[model samples]
Target: MTSTTLRGVTIDYDDLGPPAGLPVLLVHGHPFDRTLWAPQARALTGAGHRVVTPDLRGYGRSGVTPGKVLLADFADDLAALLDHLGIERAVVGGVSMGGQIAMEFQLRHPRRVRALVLSDTSAAAETDEGKRFRNRLADRLLAEGMDGYAYEVVDKMLADYNVTAMPDVAARVLEMMCATDPRGAAAALRGRAERPDYREVLAAVEAPVLIAVGADDAYTPVAEAEAIHRLVPHATLAVIEKAGHLPGAEQPERFNAALLEFLAAQV
Candidate 1:
């Protein structure tokens, strides 16, 4: 892990892939660290693309003591990570809540994003039920503490295959979940769950966009991916069968293939 100070905040990240290849920035979802991207990063780098994954502000090794940073602030941290790495423009992708931050980053600074990918993420247009879930989740986190909250989230994150066929990966994910700061996780959830709808920006993003979802992702189902695909003029939607919300971890091979195909087309 490498550390850099940006905007008076300490940012921690990992840089991989070939030095000469185009950069691919991987942003993780709630309660996860850069390690969540290891499989995807390896596959991308093996295919000749540079990969960079960062721990979000207040998550993993990154300092969260500064307190209550917004999703836009997370995006700013991404910007700082890229700048520190001397990457001018790169492909950026994220899963779930991480996808929301990626969208905000592109909207705030389009020139910095060469390509975009969203996996199992809502359009930032929450339904009454979705809002309720967010609120209830926040309340639960405060009540049960981070460890208890993490177990619930980890259950939703992975599918049967992850538990059965990929027990090691599942264990790793649980460890990361347990490591998360409950207060920080709760704060991040509250901050981003209330973000404005990005449907308009979806239609406006000119770069090649990939909207992916696992076939069995109950959290953000394939229908949501379809909606995002329809909104983006140049977006392609891919479904990884028999996987759940965290397909990049649950079904890395399938997810990596789809991502590579989309990125290759862009190049």
Candidate 2:
């Protein structure tokens, strides 16, 4: 557990593995904290890669200021984090909303990213309908609270196999969502609704890109990953079976294996 001040906001992050090892930054999605990367961090560190996972402004124990947070704000916070840690560059990865932030970070600080690992995410921006839906969700969260949202999405978050066979995993995810501060979560949703399409950004990514998604991801879906893989100049794709949006926790072994293979090729 460690902390840093970025743009007047306190950012909470976990720094693992030897300082001299190859650096990799893993960002978590909305309604979740940095702890979401625990499974992957352990695996990556054990494989000799330096793993850094940080909680974005609204989530976790990081800054909880009341305001609209642009996706670029998340990117700037990441750049500030790397600068604070004296890191020149790293392999950046994220899932869902975190993946969108990763794209924003790469666009904001190109020289700081060596490679990209986009998991269960998309390259498209929020559609007008999507924005309206998200705004309604934000309003609901701010008005009613996270309980309704958490319960409603828990089943949607994981695959049917997970919801049935992996009750503990499902429960943990629910806890993470329910534990989130309503205000912060609402702010994140509002900001996310404004994220721009990254397909054009993918065309600009010259670094190695590994796009992985669950075979049964209902939200991002496999086709979204395919679209990203097709757009990135240098990209590879992996699909883990029996997993949903959060494959890192649901299918860590397969996810780690694919990620390790990619990292090995780089280092």
Candidate 3:
């Protein structure tokens, strides 16, 4: 893992694959780190595409601070990361909250994103009730820390198929969840609850889009993916079966099949 300072925040990221290869930036979701894309990164890098995975603002290997943050703050952080690497444009991909950030990145820095991969995520604005629920989650984390919360939500964060058939993936998910900084996790959750409606942004994104979802994903189900597919022009959709919210980890083979095929068609 490598660390760099951007806007006074210490950002930790992993830069792998050929230096001159087509750039591919992978962003991790809330309560997870760049490790979330471990499997996919290896495949992408081995396939000759530069893979850069970053620990989002308040997540793993990065700073741990509690403050008000918006989705744009996270998006801008990525733009800054790419600039630090001297990358003008790259294929941007993210899972869950990371996916939302990718969409936000397209909106904020259009020329910086050559393509998009939105995985197990949604583009809708956080509803009023959703905001309150997320705030309460933050409150719980600050009050009790991540132990119980991590275990309790592990099943939901992962799919049923993952819990039963992918024990190794489940363990890793639990490990990352347990290691989450309460303040950082809380801040991220709160920040995510304030993310903007990207439906309009999705429709406007000129880059080709790929929307991938775990068939069993409960948080951002197939319906959500379909809705996003309808909005994103030139977008492709793939629903990986026998996986859940974290399909990239739960079913890497299938996930990578769709991803690599997509990349091969691009630069």
Per-residue lDDT for 117-153 in model 3, tens only? Answer: 9999999899999999999999999999988988887
**Residue-level error in angstroms, candidate 3, position 21:** 0.7
Per-model TM-score on C-alpha atoms: 0.93, 0.98, 0.98
The residue-level lDDT of candidate 3 at 215 comes to 94
TM-score of 1: 0.93
Off by over 4 Å in 1: 65-67, 127-136, 139-143
lDDT of 2 by residue, 169-194 (tens): 89889888998888888888888889
Q: What are the runs in model 2 whose C-alpha is more than 4 Å off?
A: none
Least lDDT summed over 10 consecutive residues: which range in candidate 2?
63-72
Per-candidate clashes, comma-separated: 0, 0, 0
- Which residue pairs in candidate 2 collide? none
Evaluate candidate 3 by giving its C-alpha RMSD to the native, one decimal.
Answer: 0.9
